[model samples]
Target: MPVLQTVTRETFWTIGPVGEAAFYYLAAVAILVFLYGVYARISEYAAAPADPFDRLDDLPGRVARATRLLLSNEAQFDRDTYAGVMHTFLVWGFLTLLIGTTILAIDMDIWTKLLGQPSFFVGRFYLSYSLVMDALGLLFVVGVGMALWRRYGVRESRLWGKHTDLEDDAFVWTLFALGVGGYVVEALRILGTGFPDFETVSFVGYALALLGQEAGISPATAETVYAAVWWSHSLLALGFVALLPYAKPVHMLTSMANIVTRDEQAGKRLPGVPADLPPDEIGTGSVDDFTWRERLDQDACTTCGRCSSVCPANEVGRNLDPRDVILDLKAYREERAAGEAEEVPIVADGGESVIDAESMHACLSCMACMDACPVDIEHVKQFTGMNRRLTESGEMDPHVQDAMMNVFQQGNVFGDPARKRPEWTDELEFEVPDAREEDVDLLWYVGDYPSYDERNERVAQSLARIFEAAGVSYGILYEDEQHDGNDVRRVGEEGLYEMLVEDNAAAFADAQFDEIVCTDPHSYNTFTHEYPEMAEEFDYPVSHYTEVVERLVREGQLPLSPALGQTVTYHDPCHLGRMNDVYEAPRDLVRSTGATLAEMPRNRADSFCCGGGGGGVWTEVEEERKPSEERLREAVEDTDGAVEQFVVACPMCTTMFEDGRKTGGYEEDLEIVDLTELLVEAMEAAAIDGADDTGRTGAAAD
Candidate 1:
């Protein structure tokens, strides 16, 4: 009766009217629900204040970045190898299954119906497709199994029950059930139709068919059972689609969107707040004030704890965990939307705001969380925005409030006299040029800490000696230098930060110098990255001291011994290394010191913070174990007791670790020397080796 003598195949393969109608109905409903979920979220996001999504500029570049983060899973895998591979399997399996479903649609709806073909999807090509799909389906099964094991089986990890609750558990189980159900429906189909050559390619299906055969299920009876399963599997698939909006699965879409739309400066760029704001608009007071991208950050979080895990504050048991702050904001947004929020500062009885004031102020603003986040969620910006709200509401932390007033009154964080700035230079051997008096090749922006802190003053003097021996005509702002405001802005003292920036920019404009150089990374980042817009006259090639010293060494201006026996480890300043990407310059400077370089477990972009960033040097953290101490332990262990010198390039880093070695009881073995000090020693040695009585090099003699 059949036109083709086949044991198993499908043109519509006798899919009865009832089965066909049910499948189409469920599918249509699934499509409608999925579309509705997507459209509603998109509409809500689009309604946020205009970013004028530049749809065309570097679109290909944007797509490539998305493909790396999403399609390639670069960020995910780069952090956690096992979890990355596990996630990859799930992603590939899902994509393959979706493709198979699409192909089936094309074969039936277009090939057979539209073209009136005898039918394809039947021979070797079909067999290969079937085999591939079955293997991939098994891959999906394995992935789900692994997820269950990782989520429930593993007891030590924080992966499952710690942050995720019963709802998350339900989501994973539902997903696995749907995946496993697919094969049950397939195996039943193959048995119901009388096994054939193509069915042999479906290994999972064929194996299950053998079990059914042992049970003595006749082909006709098998068909009857398949009819029931066919509807059940279809309904589950439909339900999975319908659950997209209300579950953790929603990160699938949101995370991808967040990565692709990541701002040009890689999530470090924060939108500048207007100086003049209506009373209510002073800060990001509520969800309505958040830009759409910020809202997307709340939705996109994978709750993986990568951000929270790396946060210095969180690591030290401080009140803030960046990840929880985002989650709290999301919950707070929901509560407000439902008109459930009823209290000032949103502490309804107690929990008014998503993140309370103490936790909000505890953030280091170190950007560690930003670097750790795979999805490019800017936790620092959001935390700082909330800090803005707290500062304006007069609920600012007492210490930060004191720091702000100190900056206003003394033009420095320490509340020391402004005249104390140039005092460090008086200790330098050579007469240090003051830019206000004479034109110089470089204007050294002596930072607050470098100018006044006793330990940091020696580091600043080392910089001056290196510059002098290198024959660079550099000068300092001396007493004219204002507090650079990098930390001030980070502290959310925007009013004082603006005043400082304006004052400092005016100082720069008045000074005569070819380039700007800073001994402190914080001031360097602020001058080079943050101060340009406020003062157009502040346009100069600003550089950090390490970079300038490295350049001098490269040009043979600063000759080095190039052969030493000390094992040295360089600590990358978060601002110098991660923020500005100056990892190699410092390392190269260390290399020229002729010391054997020993890296700690985490170095460069992955370098652990020294707990002195984000105004951290000024903020008092009362943790039993400090982050710098942790780093010192790492350095001691990583070098296996061989390291004699722990070199640092930033003043904050020198101060942090120099203090840490003592407080952490590591001072016995560790000596934290400035990178500039190392360079100065090496140059002096090279000068000794090459000089006649005059103490000048061959190049200088010419």
Candidate 2:
């Protein structure tokens, strides 16, 4: 039998007797460099203060959610699947390797004393553990190999293509080679030095030793090769550590840290601005206005394109790319950090270009990117803040200025006078409240579309009939309600949104209503989540029409009769579903009407936008063809011929669907109705008398 070679006895002095001294000095220098880089970056982020840390006390909950995200299937279908998997492997494997190296750093006698003799059970267990770690390290190398190949060989890989410069590719390749070479060296050491006297841990290394023997290489030669490889591996790993904070690989540490510090309820809309905040101090007007946490998010972006992949605006050929927004912000910050004084130019594929224009304006503010992001970066809120900057700073575009003026002067995007708001309700018999009067049970905020558009007026009429039939005490604002300014804010008019919120809040402050409900999801979202600061001052709850309807149905106050057995698919309005998580209430209301709900594959939080959100309903896209036409085709396909009707709860969705129905030539086959309209039909069938039912003297006998 071949004599077992020992690693301790096979040492060679390549850099003289001072080699160990040189290694220690080098390691210290690398650590200092890395620490300095981290300190600088963190200080830059700390310059901006964020929202008060309400989440700091929720550490356990944050960890639990993060663990679920890591272990669950939420990340399986991501565009960067391979990259993510490889990154995971590298993280876990490298950690284990660090433990192994620490063990090697200590005296063998000390390790034996702590773990017991090699023949003892605890020692054997550790040996098995190390062997398993070796296997994991090999697996990690294979994953890295796949990543390298994808980066270099696959031309279409978004991570590696022309979008990535050579520096990025070099960074990735160096990290890959370092990880692979480190493990290879360890395996060789195990084979050449069987002095540790553990068979299982040395399994692969022993096998390699036999192959070397068969190749006629002497035992001493193999040992020497192992030492060289080991040194090279250690040196390369040290280099990687020093380079980390400056490269994209910094995400390895920061992503995990960000995850650890992630908000327990990440996508929730933050409480609305405080009503007491002085109007002069209320708006975010520049990059200087971003909070620390927000800036951390800007730095934490991995640029994986997950946001872009799911962006409705980008998919529909709009100039906005959520990923690019983050990249630009980060790049700009980095330039600022490097003492660059020149303003960064904003460029996209289209002729559309503007310097200092908030990238937020181009965004639909849909929140799809937040849903799709693996890191849970809050793009919607950040975008909103940017828009706040442009508007509050008085640096808005001419078009945005015009739109805001229309909303402020006319109380509608169409620039129609506020007097026309009550024109739609003229044909109705019941009395609607002024909304600015004393409190009532409910306040109906009739948005511009239902008030002005002829086709949408029918929806308003349907809502009035349903309210009357449900026996619910409700009253509309009629001429008293304003536009609410969701579109104004989305179109980069923060001043207008602020003006609208303050105006609406004042109207509600004097009113006696316990809750405010609206037919338009845009108005509903702005009221429920955005206007809370103002609403809280008035002590009122802002709810969507669907939420109120769902509440009524659950309380057994509204008797719904199943008359329309038509199969219908519910389209999620971006504002209602993604912005406020009002997905279930609308569907529940539809189900209450006895319609079989056919859900689109993309429903709820992941639902595709109707191309009518974020003020797109008012602004013309000037496209060769309208985006709603495509969305209608998708909705029609999702319906699967179950019935003729498509249910919508948003005025914007109604308009988009109607246009889609016309453009797709499905006018003869399909009809779109708001959820309120469907509920009215059910109410009419039930014959229940509501508080305002003037025509009906008595409830029909059941």
Candidate 3:
């Protein structure tokens, strides 16, 4: 193959004014269309504002973080090797091609006239640039090929079933043809015209031209073919632009936007419910209660099924599919666009040819979907919002309604008297402070479960022992504490959650605690992250017990006697680990006991839910086999030959694991303990009991 030189300015000018005008007009129209798409997207956001100021302020940080994530090695996965490599190539290739196009437009339309001639930059560099682009296009085609094969050939790739496979095939094939055909056309032009300046670098084109000559095509006919192919290729490029906004290709833009606008506090423990919220203004209680950005999350879902694949609930035969939830929202949007007369039932799930109540209730509200989604669609938040809609506006199931009523009337999910909240503290030797008279530095927010549940009181006592051993300044709300309503909120009792938040907030406001520590991850998550928005709310720093233990260990306030000599696996409480991103603190606390930390295949953000979140702790949903049983099996299997002890940080997780172990027939071999329990053991082993460990103590005993 003979390498051709690029064209000179005079030669470029003679390429025909009519063809140039067509290119310019098409470019202008494409730009206008792109601008209109941007306008529509922005307008949609404008209609709903949720934490706009926070999102805006966090934008730069999110971009930097997302870029780092994209470039970093952390996102690599062995199973999706082809998809990952191809996606990276496509992203980089498209970015460079867009830059090349912009430069081409400016050089041809603006720079040439202003400077009295198009600079040699484009022609001299065009061959090399085009060759690189052509190579990338080829890579993109390969990527598309693999995607198609995965969709059609591999039954396990769930991404195939959600959307039409043919649509994907068409989209991929079209892109491939455009890239290959465009390169071929351009190469033909260079060959038919003979070697021009800087044409040597167009490797693919040069190869094609040589191949053409070898086939004995006449130069005149080749020139005609070249021109026709070139026009067709350009038209295809233009067509892709017009089709982008309506097709899955739109994810190229929305994905980045989704990443940029992702919630910064995602995975962090939600703060405790505020202490001073008025009765009327509390938790989200209905469909209209959601913030606008939460609704925007519906549009942002890419329907990748990453959430579904990782969802513990869905994997264990639960009816809730996170992917389906997002798809339903997209379907709902499509229906709205079509101006369909029928109201698409948002909660139906097929038996009635409608979304069903079980589909919504089946969700454990684990937040696993949120953790797994690449674009950061807030699946847990969306599910919670829908739950509010069904439970508060629509009539809820009888048991669910009963549970909510119990929480509302009795201040506990179990319909127990509020005064029983202090009963757990009687087992401790120390006299815990009441919120009314205590000037404690830390207010232990004893949640309903640990306070009343027979097995959970041990967790509370363990927390107290750890607090005393660490010489920390802490006290408890004792009798003054009420249910924080996390269960009620998850179970769809918005009014109860609000009332609970108000009552708890009032107690805290009247008390003298500077900080709040919670034994329950659910309470910690809600109080630390979700409570401050209520009117007249006083913001308090809330810490999970593990976080407090970690802090104490770091400060050298608490000392371990010796290694526990036990191999233990840690289970992530969804609310604590996924919702609040408190994964490390608990693990760090576990390690502080000098116990060997073994991981389940699903640990940290990928951890399985214990089937006791989102008020599932209180409501009864039928399962072929219990979700806890499935989770326990996974835990036991992960540690089948190695570890016998499973340490959990959340009260609900503790309860679920205990029950799951019994159900799964592993109860005799496995032991489940709260993180604080291990810390208490470590303290006892060291024989370093503080004064309060054996006697009644004041708020400042530590």
Candidate 4:
């Protein structure tokens, strides 16, 4: 008989003043405890050796971008669509319910008590809010169900593979009960209120109320049951909030902070070592060596194992599980934060270490872990610091040591003399110009591997032929060239890397070139990003050779006749594609030669590593399968052997994949060819009259 306006619910329907007072008392304690937990976590972060919050160049823009990213759930969807949708529902649903509750509190306490206003939680506004809350609340329930199914039913591998405790499950179950319990309480309250017409707008609760009425529950009993359930639900939700900073649920807060504070240059341009820093402080060896941001990284980890799942080292059964590195550091951080004796090392050769030496050494530094991390944990940043410590302690792999020594003594990793750097060019019919002696449009920085490695030397000469065919003015540093030290820096020899940088920067300063180009993505990456940071005056423009070639072809500077006529698959180098966002140029070059590009399952930014980054080309690690071998199999098997040629842009990838092809028994199925070699083959076929087999003709032939 009542109108909808008169069908509103009270804030404290069944509870009297005493119960209300008691509820408020518990609420105060919960709020205080939550604040204390937050403070304690902040204090721990503030105590880290360095302040990692210096990225304030665009404070407002950073916050806005991070907020947009978090809400978008783009990172969550990067590799796992199922997990992405699951997390999206959970996060949005939780926020909706939270907002609904906060509105209720404002209506009851703030607006009604402080502002002396009539309650807004009634009639039209209330009905709309109830309907919205009920619908979104179902999202929370569905998300919890999906999580349970993924974790227990389907058993997602990414969620496993690490040591987990009750807290992990407890965090999910708490959300489950909180969401489910709220529905039950809502239904009982509606039934106890006699199922008023206005309350039907809360459709989920209304339907459940009908079920309760069908069960023949009396209004008196419904009221009593609702009271008990309401208290339990409220207490559980409050307790979850209070315990957030101390349990697995802490990722909720820390993940947001980490995303907001993440370095855009993270793995691309690593933090440099100071010139005068003491040897003991060279790298991260203890909890005290961590930065505040890195400590936040420890807390931000969800233990989802996404990092480990994507890691080339971990995938092939290397000891380097990226997820374990973070968790181990987190455990040690807590122990130290608890005022325990700091006797245990963060990383060591023995059991006293939280992180093992094998795991640290096994890292390829591909940044796949960082890319896959939804929370932006910067795994490479943390791992590189530890690597520096290992280098400082003389704990490098024997191969790594030899490579470092070679770079130090010979200005290259192959232990070859400087005069031999230009030996690869002697095979070319045309003489390659020396950059030091004359100005050129392009300074071809033929990196160490391409300069000296026999397998890659032919590829370098092919690029030189391509340059001659296009009539582009390009020159090499010749004997003046030194190693770029990209991989050396990744391997953590700060002093050696500095020496290499200094030597190369001097050559670069002396050379007269409009732009620097490299066939080595590793060299291109460091020259474009790290070199300028270390060398004050080394700010020359740099381009990958693929980018240069692709542009030349596009602009008709280099004519192509599409003479390849072969089905090929292209591999994206980590430094080029993922780290530097140069994904399409090399593929464009592959297509320029009239090759049919059959896409690999993992292409572009998702391309699998060739196991040659971070000095992986130098260091040897035993594994069930090498990452290079695994990738070769993917190109051959995933493409069903349709790919006759495996085209790569990087000299490092060329070296790694050539070995992989031979050893993995893919020699018959695939041929590992550099993009330049493939391009040169097409260019030679396109050459007109007076053109020799070397593709030089007309004015170039003269």
Candidate 5:
């Protein structure tokens, strides 16, 4: 093959002095408007309160990570492959075009104009640039086509949300015009040049030029067409730039900033209210109450309903839609910016509330929204803040208020006497040692549900049997243990949550143990993540029961017989799998029980909530269907009749699924068994009953 000759194109071939001057003047105005928009946005964000958790450490590392996520579209791809491909094409394609334009500007304005240097818009470089620009521009147009098709042709519901505006159309159409128009202008330019051999490197343009020639377009006419098309394309692009900050495409900048500054532990670990905060200002009452990062989150939202689509509350037809929550906040922010500064409530009852009380109460706080958000918006955190104000103002749910009162009066949500906390251990062959009185290797923090709820009490008993069979030295805080405050905190009762935390911390401080292990994922989450924030000396390592059980099974500490031979599906408790990232261990444990682990449609990180979190267990919301019922149906139907047993590690999941199993009439089809129950069955099949070394029936030998 012959070596291709160098090719170059004229930047202003058809434009006269007057046209060039007009172009420059318009370009300057567009640039100034763009800069002003950017500055105004930055100033608006800066004016908001600082995010307590938004630490600026490791900025370079953060930028690098954010760049990787943006370039790879990993998070977006994880949700939808079509969207991922379209977004990647659009981003990289548009970026390449922008870069090519910037290079042209540098060559013309900087190298030649300022330094009087020879223009480098020639030789192999220009040829390569032309080829790359043509190829990527085609991709850019394809991305625009895909976007339009997805939004309009396929009519993807996730793309259109409550806050979706005409601006969305404007953004997409402008992009479509610019991308297609650029190629049209290039084709016109090539056609005017008589389809030169070197211009073939701009293959799309060359092909279009050849087509135009075949259609009987003369060179003079092509030149005339080029001038008008070039001017239109340029102006369209400039107008897009000028309108950037005011349109849906503003996410282009805000998203990058949001992602770069995102808290990795956002939903998993929430920021607590400052002690000095006034009673009236406990939560986000108005626009001014939100942190700068949260305000940035509002702007960063691309109006994609990924968060709402994945939300269990929304999925179950509850009033809470995470996308609406963010967009509502954004609308309020804009309204506030436009001079509505009367300290209006963000969430209120029967008033001109930006977010309604029902929507606030409807949130499950399962972090499903946060998990689905590609822009890394902390939907859980934002809602939790709003909940604080609700709780402070006594506008919270009646059941939640009762639960809070129960927690305050009885140290548990069940309102059971403290003496009854250890009653679950009565039927067990072994006695769970009191951690306050005994020194043990593992301090088992038996959470409220396991200690009080009869069904979950059986699960706690099963765990006790497993501990006995494994010969693990574990003790419980029993009556001394208060509630973990995980759900309380999530429900927006920060003061009550702190009170519980302090009470639990005091119990922990008195307990003598090497490490703390929790039966409930909710308890484990707060113990491992939130507890240390309040209790500085709270240094004991914490683990969910699954982690400890998995280790024991791995170490051959538990007697194993895969004789169950049943097909089972594991329900990922949101706090365990999504919040804590302890997915594999429970699945491994299920497999270890000689059961075939059939996964549901959504599992692990994408696991559906059981409608038991964010005080969903405490508050009653009449919905078309419960999230737990939906989850059970998913397990029963989605697994193609393979799942006979629905195994879960969380007591909350057990409570919810059991209730759902009855309510959904799925009791005949599925059994909601806990991980500990399965483990006990597996060990019992191996002939290892709860027998101790001293032959005292594994009870506390007094």
Candidate 6:
């Protein structure tokens, strides 16, 4: 019922003369080792090629944000709730314990020695500090216990891979030992010193001490046990610090630095290949090719495996393992740094190289891994850089090459005639103006799929209808428009992507539009996210069609009444949902159709990819089942048989689901349609029903 406020306590309560002197010797050695480890790791980062953090602006803001994120681990908690709670407890506990030790050191070495100044760790402050520190130590143990359970209890956990790795095991337990051992020293000290008044403050220690008394241990023996345990705890702590340079446990020190200095780029920014890559440079051939931030990313990994758990490639049984890639890179880099002559394990890890053409081709660039990663390692960026070099070497996936060739031959990836892009527009009841022909409010960037794919062309037409209904003045580039280069850069053909960016920028310049609106999320992501530097003068706002439709419906510009009343499910396109944060718009548009929106388990930021992003649609993944089919099955399962439609916004997603329906044999079970199609149907139905109501009311009155 009462809180233990504070009490006076000696700083070095248990240590004998030898033990007291031994502490300084061990600490000095630990300090030297820690400095060496920090320096060596710093040098490794300094030598890296890309330092994304260097480009960050708003220093005060970045620092303040970093402080909050690092202290609270809120970013991790936002997505991974259970683990976040565990980690938050562990991190804060360790910090509080460290503060306790520092304050004790100050009491002994600084405050007590200062003339006329009383030590802060006395009376109420000491009792409260001791109690909080004891509680935090228990908290630390609980967190570590949960981590152990998670790593071992779950059969298919990503953490098992790291735990099973023989090399990291010792380091893992060493840190674990340091965390759990401190309490042991405290218990013995309390039993020997007979600190009954302080029992409430260090209750965990008191409990253990009580057990020792019941066992009939004498005070003299308890003193001996206390000294022995104290020395062991101190030595282990020193050893843990010393082992930082030799083990992955260094993440405890480096992850915070990496978190604070993390880059400004997120899901929106893909790694761009500079035209000026060194003539002899082989991308990711060694760790040096990566930037300091990326190399620092290696040290930042906690072996939590959150990234791999959400990775679509791994989910679909692809050879690419996001977690393994980082671990392999760290191991190989360390080997190389140690001057071993063996070829770097980076290009090939085990039987398969994560950087190999086969593995590299499997990535969807969906940002699922990045979204799930607590440490914020740029897995996609690193993989894409390697894939790009592989493409330059003519080692790209064959299906992807065909698509790239299509871009070269035609302005789009479909290799269809440029004139056919706008042919679908002829069927529209109203004229969709040409941006190149006249000034318009929005320039519609008809990407490769909607312009040519028969399935998506209809969706594009439906979207145009919605625009017309909203009284939007929109136009298209028609034959002049080119691909937005999102997937091109993702597929690692930076050279070709640049050509596409330049061509599209030229067409955009020629088009007299106030802003850019696109049906394809890939184009929307690139034009707004990736191409501002390319088109500086044409600084028009780039937005996806769902955003436009959602706004129109919200503003009463597009009247809609739910007609079908069918239960609908929405599939978030990776580019649109996770990458661009456009989850709400499509959902809004779907609900406006009077359709009940059923949600699959993995929606919003956790949305499953349709398996078309990062040119996955063009690549031949060797999985028995594609992600899109699995996603379709998930939608079906979530709806419990009532869902009438699966609504999507991205054209690539439309095509992926269409093909998947046939391949997965779900053609009769579900239907895939665009969000715009639903909105259009709802708007037209509202119009017809309004007119019918007017006529019926007049007839009744007459």
lDDT of 1: 0.78
lDDT of 1 at 211: 89
Residue-level lDDT tens digits of model 5 in 1-702: 124334577899899889988998999999999999999998987888999885578999999999999899998897699889988899889999999999999999899999999888887888889999999988889999999999999899878876788888988899999998988898898889888788889999888888999999989999988888999999999999998987787999999999999998897778988889899988989778889899989999988889889998888888888888898888877877787655577888778888899998888889988888899988888999999999889898999889989999999999989999999999987677878888999999998999999999998898898888799999998889899999999988888888888888888888788889899999998988888988898888999999998999999898877878899999899999999899999988888878998889898899999999999888766656888999999998899557889999999889888888888889899898998999888887767433433456445566
Q: Which residue runs of candidate 1 sit more than 4 Å off their true CA positions?
A: 1-8, 11-15, 51-57, 110-120, 160-163, 207-222, 340-351, 691-702
Best by lDDT: 5
lDDT of each: 0.78, 0.68, 0.69, 0.86, 0.88, 0.78
Clashes of 6: 4
Better of 4 and 6 by TM-score: 4
Compose the digit string of candidate 4's lDDT tens values, residues 477-498: 8988888988888888988988
Q: Write one digit per residue (lDDT tens) for candidate 2, span 1-702.
A: 113222122223333447766777888898998999899778866677655445456778777877776544355345456666765666566666667656654433344546564422235445565576677676666667766776667844345322356667776688678766754654456555542565446565555656666787665675778757767876887888887888887876666556666554443343345557565444454356567777777767776677887887777777677877776676666666577745432322223432235345456667789878777787776666655545555655556567668888887876888888888878888765565654568888888889888888988888876676567777767666788777676655655677787777776666777777888888776665556644458455678888887888888877777666888888788778877778888888888888888886677877778777665665555554456666666767765556567788888788877886887687876688888888887786666434436445445432
What lDDT does candidate 1 reach at residue 399? 75
Give candidate 4's TM-score. Answer: 0.96
Would you give me the overall lDDT of model 6? 0.78
Error of 3 at 653 (Å): 0.5
lDDT string for model 3 (265-321, tens) is: 653323223447553334343233335566556666655677888777787787778
* Predicted candidate 1, C-alpha RMSD: 3.7
Candidate 6, which segments miss by more than 4 Å at Cα? 1-7, 50-56, 113-120, 154-156, 278-282, 344-354, 639-641
Q: What is the TM-score of each candidate against the true structure?
A: 0.92, 0.82, 0.85, 0.96, 0.96, 0.94
Off by over 4 Å in 2: 1-19, 48-91, 98-122, 142-163, 194-197, 202-218, 257-291, 339-341, 344-360, 388-400, 429-439, 534-536, 637-643, 663-669, 682-702
Task: Give the local distance difference test score of model 3.
Answer: 0.69
Off by over 4 Å in 3: 1-82, 113-115, 122-124, 131-139, 153-156, 190-200, 207-221, 266-296, 348-354, 433-435, 535-537, 639-641, 688-702
C-alpha RMSD of each candidate structure in angstroms: 3.7, 5.8, 6.0, 3.1, 4.0, 2.8
Query: What lDDT does candidate 6 reach at residue 323?
Result: 83
